[model samples]
Target: MDFQHLSYFIEVVRHASFSKAAQILHITQPTLSKIIKNLEDELEVILFNRTTRYIQLTDDGEIFLKFAHLTLSMADDLQVSLNDGKLLKKGKLSLGLPPVIGVSFFPHIIAKFRDLYPGIHLHLIEEGGKIVEQLLRDAKIDLGVVVLPVDERHFDFIPLVERQLSLIVNSNHTLAKQEIVHLSELRNESFILFKEGFSLNDRVREACIREGFEPVISYESSQWDLISEMVGVGLGIALLPETVLGRIHTESVKVIPKTVPQISWDLAVIWSKHHYLSHPARGWIQFIREWVWLQRSMI
Candidate 1:
C-alpha cells in the first residue's frame, strides 16, 4: 500500500513475530496488527500464517515480499536520482565496517574525510564482515568494507588492504625467538581466534586445514584486542595481520612473520551493484582510492 506498510511487513517477516516487529518499529502491537489486517483486507489475501508465538509467510505473502522489496528499492533509486545534484553540497553516507577493520584502519581515514568534507554526514555501522556482506545484499547501507573475494555477481569492489597474516606469541613462549614460523610448526599449539562471523576466522581455519591440522582453538572473540590479550596471558598463540599487530599495545606478545602456505588478510570496499550508489558514496570511494595510492607511493 505504502512504503511504511511494505517496511512494516518486511520487518514482521524478518523477525517472524508480530510483537517483535512492532517493538522494533516503535509502534504498539495492536496498531501494527490493525495495519496489517487493513493491508490484508485491501489486498484480499492473508499474508501470514499466524500462530500464538510466531508467524510464517503464506504462498501469497512470499510472492508479495519480492515485489515489496523491489518497490522499496525503486523508491530509494528515485530519491537518489532526484537528489543527485544537491548531494554534493551536503549529504549523508552509511558505511558498514567490521570492528576489526574499523579499529585497524578507518579512524584516521574518517578524520581525514570529515576534515575534507565537513558537510557530509558519515554514519558508521559496525558489524562482522559476514553481517556487513548481508547488509550490502539487503541494501541497508550505502557501502561497506569487507574481506576480499566478495560475490562478484552481485557487487562491485575495490581492493584496499592486502598483506599476509603474522603470528603472535607470548614473549616467553618457545616460538618467540623465531623471526618466521610455518603453519605446520604450530600444529601442537593452542590458537586464539576471531569468532565465526569474521572472515579472518574462516581464513585461519582453512589455512590450518590446508597445512594438515585443525588448530586447537582455546578461545574465540569478536574483538582483536581481546584475542591479543588472550595471547598476552599465554592462553594461546594467534595469527593476525601486521596492520593490526602494529596498532596493538602489548609487551608480552612477539610478532613473527608467517611462512609456508601464507594466509593473506585482504580487505576491500564493496557496494551492491544491484542498488544505486549515491554521489557522496562515489566521492568517498574515490577518496579511498587516492589515499591508498598515496600510502603505497610513500612506502
Candidate 2:
C-alpha cells in the first residue's frame, strides 16, 4: 500500500476511531473508513472490531499496528531529511544585526546568499548592538552581530570588523586644528552620544569615566548623522567610526586623530553559547566563516 493509505490506517488506529482520525487528518470519516477497509481487504484480514459503543482493533489489527508505527516513523525521518537539506535548500533563518553594521555589510552577502540557496528565506531584524545581544540571549533571533568585549561566557562568536573611531567636532571648535586628540581632553566638552541600548554609548561613557570624569551629556540620539549634525552646529563633539564619516558631509564636521588609547569599533557575529543551531543557521555560520576567510586571504 502507498504511504497515504498507510498513514491513514496508522492515524485511524492511533485514535481507535475513524471519526476522530478523520477530524485530526482533516478528511471525512467515510473516506477514512473506506481506506481502512481497502487496506484490510488487500491484506485479506479483518483490521477492526466495530460495535455500537466502541471501536477496537482485531487480533490481526493489533499485530499490523506495530509494523504500521515503524513504517510511519521511518517516513517521518525521511521527510525531515528531505526538507532539512544539507545544502540549506529549504529553511528559514532569523538574524539580528546593528542597523549601521547591517547597512554596511549585508547588501552584497545577502544577495549572494539568495543566489546560493534560493529556497532559504532570510529574515533580518535590525536594532542596536545591545538590543541585538538581548535578542540573542532571549532566543528571539537565531544569530546576531554584537560589539566586542561583551559577556563572552554566554556567546560563541567570530570576529567581524574593526574600524578606528575619530573625534568629531565643529570645524570652528577649538580642538578642530589639533592633529591628535586625547579622550581626557574631551572630559569637559559637552557630548552628543547614542541612546541607552547602544553598546557604543556604553563604551563612550565608560571611556570618559575611565578618563576621570563623567561625560557632560548635551544630546543623545540613535542616528550617528544626527549626532554629526549636532556637532556640525557646535552643539557638542562626538566619537564615530571612520566608516560612517564617508556618509556624512565631510565639511560639516572636522575629524581629528583620536589617540588616548585609540578607540576601535570591534564587532563579531554571535549566537547563544547553549542554543542548538538548526541546519539553516549552521549553514549561515559556515557561509559567513568562509566568506570572512576569503576576504582576509585577498588582503
Candidate 3:
C-alpha cells in the first residue's frame, strides 16, 4: 500500500469531513475521494461509514488507523534520520493555539522560530484550550498551546507560563480602587466572560461556585478585548489573564489582583504521548524549553 495514500486516509478520518481533510492535505475533494476509493478497493473493506452529518470509521478502519499512525510516525522519523541532522529543511507544522496565546506571545515566538527554520511551513488554529487538546488527540495538529492541568498521563507538556487572573471593572465602579478583590465581594456582580468551551470560562465559574454564588454572565465572547470593552462600559466585570490585559488599552477599566481563591492558568505546549512528533515539532519544544525559558531567566 502506498504510504502517501495511507496518509490521505488518515487525514480523512482525522478530520471527519472530506472537504476539510482535502483542504488540509492541499488536494481537491474529488481527488481525495478517489484516493480513499482506491484504498477501499485494494483492501476490500469499507473503511468509513458516511452520512450527511458525519463520516466515521468502520471496524476495519479503526484497526487500520492504529497501523497508519505507526507507519506515518516511523516514516517521519526515518526522514529525520536520513537527513543527517539537518532538521527542518522542509516540513509542515500544524499547530493549535488558544486565542489568549495567539494574541499575546504566539506571533513573536513563531517569528523567531521561522527565522531559525525558514523551510518549515506553519498551519495554525486558534481555538479554546479544550478544542486545541482535542485537535492534538485527533492528529489534526502537530502541537498545541493549551492551558494546563491537562491529562498528563496521555500527553507531555512543557509549562510556558502561569498568568494571574485579574479582576477588570469600570474605572468608576465601586470596586475599582481596591488592590485585591475577594471572590465573595462580586457575589452580585454580572460578569462578561469567554464562551463555554474556554478553560477560563469554566475556571471562573467553578471558582465563583466555590465562593457560594453563581456568577451572573452578562455577555459571552471569544475576544478578550470585547470582554474588556464590555466591562469598561459597565456592562459587567471580567476576569482575564494579566498577559492579555497588558496587550490592550483598557483606559476605562481598572485591573485588580484576584485572591480569596486566587485564579490563574498555567500555559503549556502539549502533544499527545501516543502521536509521532516530527523533528520540527520536537525541536520547537526544545527551543521553548531551552531558549524561551532561558530568556525568561535573564529577565
- Name the 10 consecutive residues with the lowest summed lDDT in model 1: 81-90
Let me know the TM-score candidate 3 reaches against the reference structure. Answer: 0.71
Query: Model 1 clash pairs?
Result: none
- Which model, 1 or 3, shows the larger lDDT? 1
lDDT of 1 at 107: 92
Per lDDT, the best of the predicted structures is 1
lDDT of 2 at 131: 93
lDDT of 1 by residue, 156-227 (tens): 988887888899999999989998788899999999988888888889999999999999999999888998
Q: Which stretches of candidate 2 lie above 4 Å from their native place? A: 1-85
- Of candidates 3 and 2, the better by TM-score: 2
Q: Candidate 2 residues 136-159, lDDT tens each?
A: 889888998877977889998988
| Ranking of predictions according to TM-score | 2, 3, 1
TM-score, per-candidate, Cα-based: 0.69, 0.74, 0.71
Model 3 clash pairs are: none
**Which candidate comes out best when scored by TM-score?**
2
Give the CA lDDT, 0 to 100, for residue 294 in model 2.
91
